[model samples]
Target: MKILLTGITGQIGWELQRTLMTVGEVIPVRRNEMDLTQPNSISGTIQQVKPDLIVNPAAYTAVDKAESEPELAMAINGIAPGIMAESAKKVGAALIHYSTDYVFDGANTTPYTESDKPNPQNIYGKTKLVGEQAIASSGVPHLILRTSWVYGLRGKNFLLTMQKLAQEREEIKVVADQIGAPTWSRVIAETTAQILSQARHHVSDFLVSKGGLYHLTASGQTSWYTFAQAIFAHDVQHSERKLQNLIAITSKEYPTAAKRPAYSLLISQKLSNTFGLFLPDWQKTLELVLSE
Candidate 1:
């Protein structure tokens, strides 16, 4: 099977490139090779590759920056997936795209499910939601997996940021109100690979039957303050730590250009029930990544 994987440099894409290799011949494409913001680039790449599966983990992910760059963000995060879906349809290929928990406004106390109505509070969330809608309407065989709080040893994510700040500052303040799983990139990648592996010889038919939206995330949830505490506690390189305190503050304490969901924890029950794949708890995954 031939698979066209995008965002080779991203956190999730970096890991997906490695894991997906076990299932098929992986053709990893960088941004320069297949820019999502360009419709011709997206369509032309798919047409050239003619892959059986097109796994796209690429998007405009800057939360706060997206407020000022709405057009650019919409082009990538909102319009790109629809174009990819259309392209995939022409080639009779299945698509797997990653989405976010930010599609919700974080109003509910319980974890957000796939059936929940999305009320995005910020530009990033709004754009991601639009992408989800596009893929669903394209009539293409696809799986829109919604994950949250993604981090890996390599990307510009909360995990790396906390580790960097731990060594540079004595006192670091984090928002305690926002809650969600701190999913490791490897877990997401591996789980996705496992699910696709089951499709095997009948990839498109499988996706057509089980395709749609599903929440894929770590088992447990935590706030940014607590997540940072875990990072420090499980730091393999403890010698690099600074002196003082890890302060917990509300979202208002540290305002940003975009308003984030106060509680965006996603329920992975649908994913598990459908694929029989479950990601480990956020804490366990964090420890494993740090240990490695």
Candidate 2:
């Protein structure tokens, strides 16, 4: 199968290139090659490639910066995927898109399900929700995977940031109130490959059965503070880096331009039952990521 993948340089997209290559011929397009902010460029790129599957890993991921640049966020994260979906529909191809747990307000005490109502509290979440809505409304066979707390060895993510800070400072302060599952980009890429390899069958069943937005994350939950501690501990054991102290603080203390959900943990029972795929715990995934 011929597959066209966007955001090839991103954390997930970087891993996806390796995973997807095992299944089919993957044509990865970077941002410089194909700008997502341009609607016509998105449509033109897809039409030119005419891929059998379109995996869009690119998105407006700057949470704080999105507050000041809502239009650009909407164009890249909201409308672009819809345009890709339309192109996929025209050519009878499957479209796979990634979303975030921020689509919902963290007001719920329990983990959110696919059926949960989305009330995005921030501009980033609202824009991603708009993208999901556009894809669903396009009447194309699509899979929207809503994930959270994504990190990897590469890219500008929490893991790399923590590693950098741990090297420079003796103590690190992280928020302990916000809780969610941390997902490795490698895991997401592997799962995406697994799903896409069986795309023909899964797409057919998903259209008639359980298809739409599904939560894809690690099996457990933890706050940022605890997660940072784990990272430090792991590094101390395996690497030369030694952390002196790691402090836990509330979200209010670590203020940002955007308002984050207190708790946005997503339950993935639906994805598990439908795809027969269950991701490992966050700790286990972290170990693998760090080892790599």
Candidate 3:
């Protein structure tokens, strides 16, 4: 089988290249090769490649910046996926897309479920929600995996930022009001591979029975302060790093253009039941990530 993968430079996309290699020939494309902003380009590229599967890990992920560039965000995160889905349908190919937890307003006391109604508060969230809707509306085989707080060893993410802060500053302050699971890119890539493997092997029932939106995040939950503290402790024990005075503050203290959810933890029960897969705890995933 042949697969067309986008966003090869991104954290999850980068890891996906390696994970997806186990399945079949992967035609990984970067932004230079296929610009998502141009919907016409997407259809033409997919038609040219004629891939059996399309994995779209690329997205407009700058949460704060998206507030100012809503049009660009919508174009890439919303309209592009629809175009890709349409093309995928034309060629009888399946599409796999990634989404974020920002789709919800973040007021829930419990983890967000697949069945929850999406009420996005920010431009980024709205755009991603649009993408999800487009894919769902398209009569194409698709899987929308909504993940949260994604970090990887190689990406410009929370873990890397915290590591830099720990090295430069004697003290650090992190938001304690917001809570969610910190997921690793490697783990997400592996899960995507597992899901793809299942789909490829069980072709008849794959899209009809199990192709839909699902939450895929590392298990457990913690505030940003707790997560930073854990990272510091792990770094000190594993490396010669030393950081002091880790302060936990409320969200009001640090302001951002976008209003983030107070609690955006996603429950993976539907994903687990559908795919027969379970992710490791957040802490364990962190350990493995840091070890690398």
TM-score of each: 0.99, 0.95, 0.97
- TM-score computed on alpha carbons, candidate 2: 0.95
lDDT of 2 by residue, 1-292 (tens): 7889999889999999999998788999988778998877888888889887888989999999999999999999999989998988887777889999999899999999989999998999999999999999998878899999999988899888998887777778999999999999999999988876665544534543545788999999999989988887666443545457889999999999989999999998988888899989999988877776
| Predicted structure with the largest lDDT when compared to the true one | 1
Q: What is the descending lDDT order?
A: 1, 3, 2
Writing each residue's lDDT as its tens digit, candidate 3 over 1-292 gives 6889999999999999999998878999988789999977899999999988899999999999999999999999999999999999898888899999999998899999999999998999999999999999997888899999999888689998998877777778899999999999999999999887887654325876778899999999999999998887676443545566889899899999999999999999998998899999999988887776
Candidate 3 off by > 4 Å:
201-205, 236-242
Position 271, candidate 2: lDDT:
83
Clashing pairs in 3: none
- What's model 1's lDDT at 15? 95
lDDT agreement of model 1 with the native: 0.93
Q: Output the lDDT of residue 80, model 1.
A: 95
